[model samples]
Target: MLNVDGLKNGIVIDHIQAGMGIKIFNYLELDKVNGSVALIMKVSSKKMEKKDIIKIENVVDINFDMLGLMDPNITVNIIEDDKIKEKIKLSLPKKVENLIKCKNPRCITSIEKYIPHKFYLVDEEKSEYRCEYCDEAYKLEF
Candidate 1:
């Protein structure tokens, strides 16, 4: 077995959707970061088919909006001196603006260039969101 050391004074994003790791990584700009960062993607998990785990050492000021877009089930673990100091459990916000561009061409967001794309949660159990203007349906997975 390989030994993966713990992070010191940073964060761990867990419970990410299997293939959305790169999207989250790009959205978070983890590649351009200067600090020590580790992205272990598609790791086997009993709870999930595959999961992505990102460890960033000595970093804060995370982007919440981009995180929400990638995976709503993501959990932020804050480590201090290589010990778990804090945990941030996030819930899917009922409404998200501007983070995602509506795919529906008929959607108001796609039609109107100025109006911010707004989506409201229609089904929390299924993680479904609908456009407020054009009634476009979107299923956002965890």
Candidate 2:
């Protein structure tokens, strides 16, 4: 019977895998936000058995690509006037830049300081990505 108030205008990040709420919270820099933010972890869910939820009291700019990369199962709900205005389903991003670094020692990215690390989805089922320059593979583990 834990009760949390509905947001009048804000964003609700739902369906975060259990134990990931803190990571998402930190990634979003919620601690530095001036508005109210509630991070509820380990909530019961029939779909996931356990999940985390983050409620922000004011709308904030979010990088959806980074969010998707962190957890593709997450859903973003935009609230306005205490009602859901939009529901966004996240999936693995097809392309990402500067999010994941090319770990290959001989990669050009390692030699060039000005280059932005870039990766492209190579295998969706395996959550695998390849470095755009070096073809080094990186896999995301949920």
Candidate 3:
């Protein structure tokens, strides 16, 4: 069995979908962090059957909105003094900027390099987002 030590003061990103942990790890730039970080993948879970977990040995800033978009099922646990200080459940963000690109060729965002790519959640069930400027639809696939 694989064993990973618990954190004393850091964050635990739990319930990451199998195979998605590496993406999240890379996105968070865990490789560059000075603190100890552990990426455990393909752990058996009763709730999910399989999941990934990331443990950090020092507190770090995270963008929860981006995480929600990537995987709404993820949960964040803050650890302090070897105990869980707080638990944060993630959900799809109502609005996001610059994370998703507008694909419409004629959209202003496409023409203007300075324009930020903006999208609004149109369908939570479908994981659908629409470009704020062009109304172009983008469906997230995970």
Candidate 4:
């Protein structure tokens, strides 16, 4: 049995899809930051069959919108004194900039280096976000 200690004060990113924990870890720059972060992968889950988990032993506000865009099913648990103080259910943001790059090569953002890669929520039910510059559609692949 793999045993990991509970966080004293930090955030727990739960309900992550299997194989996505590393993406979230890199996205948050956990490696560069000096803090205790545990990335548990391939855990059995009743709902997902298999899932990943990330426990950060430090209070830091990460980009929730990016999490939502990547995996809207993710749950954020804010811990304090080894207990959950708040539970945050992630939702896709209306607009996300620089988090996701526009893949369209002909898009202005792709041509111009200075412009930020911006996407807008086009279809909430489908979890579709379109590039603001070229209207390129992007959907989260589960």
Model 1 lDDT tens row, 5-74: 7876888988877777777777778888878888888889888989988888886688676686567778
Error of 3 at 122 (Å): 0.6
Q: Rate the local accuracy (lDDT) of all candidates.
A: 0.80, 0.96, 0.95, 0.91
lDDT of 3 by residue, 1-142 (tens): 7778888899999999999999999999999998999999999999999999999888999999999999999999999999999999999999999999998999999999999999999999999999999999999999
Write candidate 4's Cα lDDT for 1-142 as tens digits: 9999999999999999899999999989988767899999999999999999999987887988889988888999999998999999998899999988888989998788999999999898988889998899998676
The per-prediction CA RMSD against the true structure, in angstroms, equals: 2.6, 0.8, 0.8, 2.0
Q: Candidate 1, residue 45: CA error in Å? A: 3.5
Stretches > 4 Å off in candidate 3 = none
Give the Cα-based TM-score of candidate 1 against the true structure. 0.78
Better by TM-score, candidate 2 or 1 = 2
Clashing pairs in 1: none
> Which residue pairs clash within candidate 2?
none
Each model's TM-score?
Answer: 0.78, 0.97, 0.97, 0.85
lDDT of 1 at 5: 78
Candidate 2 residue 122 C-alpha distance from true site, Å = 0.8
